[model samples]
Target: MIRIVIVDDEVFVRAGFSALLSLADDIEVVGQAGDGAEALSVVRQTVPDVVLMDVNMAPRNGLEATLQIVKLPEAPRVLIMTSASPDNTAWQAFATGAHGFMHKAATPAQIIGAIRMVAVGGTATTPEVMKRLIDENNLRNPRHVAQARSRIDLLSGRHRDIILLVGRGYPNARIARELSMSENTVKSYVSRALEKLGVDNRTQAALLVRDSGLLDETLANESRVL
Candidate 1:
C-alpha cells in the first residue's frame, strides 16, 4: 500500500480528502495535519510514502513545510495542492523539491492519480501549470540553464552519467544494468548525486539535468562508444 499524509489548513478539506482517499485500496491515509508545522510532525511520525499538502496555510505555508520535509532522512514525496493561481506559487513549489502540483479544483480522479504518480517517482504537474512555470519564469532561459549546468558540473563523471540516465527516465534497476552496477550501488550513487545537486528527489534532478542540456550531449557522445 502507498502510505500518505494529508496536510491542509482547513479541517473540512483534510477530512474530505481523507474520506475520498479511503476508497483507494492501493492508498492508505496514514496521517493528517491542519498546518505546515503539524504536517511536519505528522510526516516525521508516519514516515509516509507520499504527502498531499495545500500551498496556503497560516504561520508556515506549504513551501516552507516542503523545504523542511525534503531535508528529512528518507523524505516522503510531496504533492502540493493549491486553490489559488499557479502563477502565485507553482514556481516556489518546484523549487522546494515538490514531486507534483495540482489545483484544488481538480477532479477526484485527478487528485488520486496525482498522488499515485508522485508515489512512484513521477511528476504530476498539468501541462498548463508547467507552461506557466516555463513561459512565465523562463526556467529554460539561458541564465537558468547556465546555473543548472554549473550545479551539474559539481557532480563527478560517474554521478553525471547516472543523473543523465535518470533524466532519461530509467528506473534504478535499469540504471544499474546500464552502468553495470548492483541496484543498491545505483541507489547509493543516485542518492549521493541528488544530494550534491541539491535536489530532494530524482524528478527534480531530472529537471536539472534536462535544463543543463547534459543529457543531449551525453546521447550525442554515445557514438564514440562504438
Candidate 2:
C-alpha cells in the first residue's frame, strides 16, 4: 500500500483529502496536518511514502516545508497540492525538490495518480502548470530561440519534427494524425527524442527545446516553406 500524509492549513481540506485517500484501496492516510510545523512533526514520526503538501500555510509555507522534508534522512517524495497558479508558485515547488504538482481542484483520481506517480519516483506536472512554464520561459528568454535552433540542428529531421510538435503541446494522438503515423509510432518517436535530448520526459524535452530557442526557428522554417 502507498502511505500518504496530507498537509493543508484548513481543517476541512486536510480532512477531505484524508477521507478521499483512505477510500483508495492502495492508499493509506498515515497522518494529516494543518500547518507546516505540524506537518514536519508528523512526517518525522510517520515517514510516509508521499506527502500532499499545500503551498500557503501559516508560520511556514509549503515551499519551506518541502525543502525541510527533502532534507530528512528518509525523506518521502513530495507532491505539492495547492490552489496557487503554476506561474507564481509551481517552479518554486519544483526547485524545492517536489516530485509533482497537483491543483486542489483536481479530481480524486488525479490526486491519487499524482501520489502514486511520485511514490514510485516519477514526476507529474499538470498540463496547466506545464503551459505556464513554457509561457514564462518564452517571455523571459529571448536567447532561447537561438538555443532551440542549435538543439534542433543536432537531431535527425524526424526527431526535430517530433520535438516541434511536443513544444506546441500536441498530444501523441494529434502528433500521430498530423504526421500520418500510428500512436505507438508517435510514442516511440517521443521516447527517442527524449533520449537524444538527454531528458527524462516530454515536459523536460519541451522545456529544453523552448529554452534553446528552437521554437521560433521551427515556426519560421515552416512559415517559409508555406
What TM-score do all the candidates reach, one by one?
0.81, 0.65
The residue-by-residue lDDT of candidate 2 on 1-226, one tens digit each, is 9989899999898889988887789999989888888899999999999899999999988889988888798988889988866667877777676778889998888888888767755567777887787677667555556666576667887788888787665667778889999988888888888788766556556556667766756788889999
The lDDT leader among the candidates is 1
Candidate 1 segments exceeding 4 Å error: 137-141, 154-158, 168-185, 198-200, 213-226
Error of 1 at 101 (Å): 0.9
Q: Write the per-residue lDDT of candidate 1 for residues 1-226, one digit (tens) a residue.
A: 9999999999899999999999889999999998899999999999999999998898899999999998799799999999998885876787788888899888889899888878866678777887775475444579887998999999887898898888765768778888899989989999999899887788789778878877767777886785
- Return the clash pairs for model 1, or none: none
What's the lDDT for all of these models? Answer: 0.86, 0.80
Clashing pairs in 2: 144-212, 144-213, 145-213, 147-212, 148-212, 148-213, 148-214
How much does candidate 1 score in TM-score?
0.81
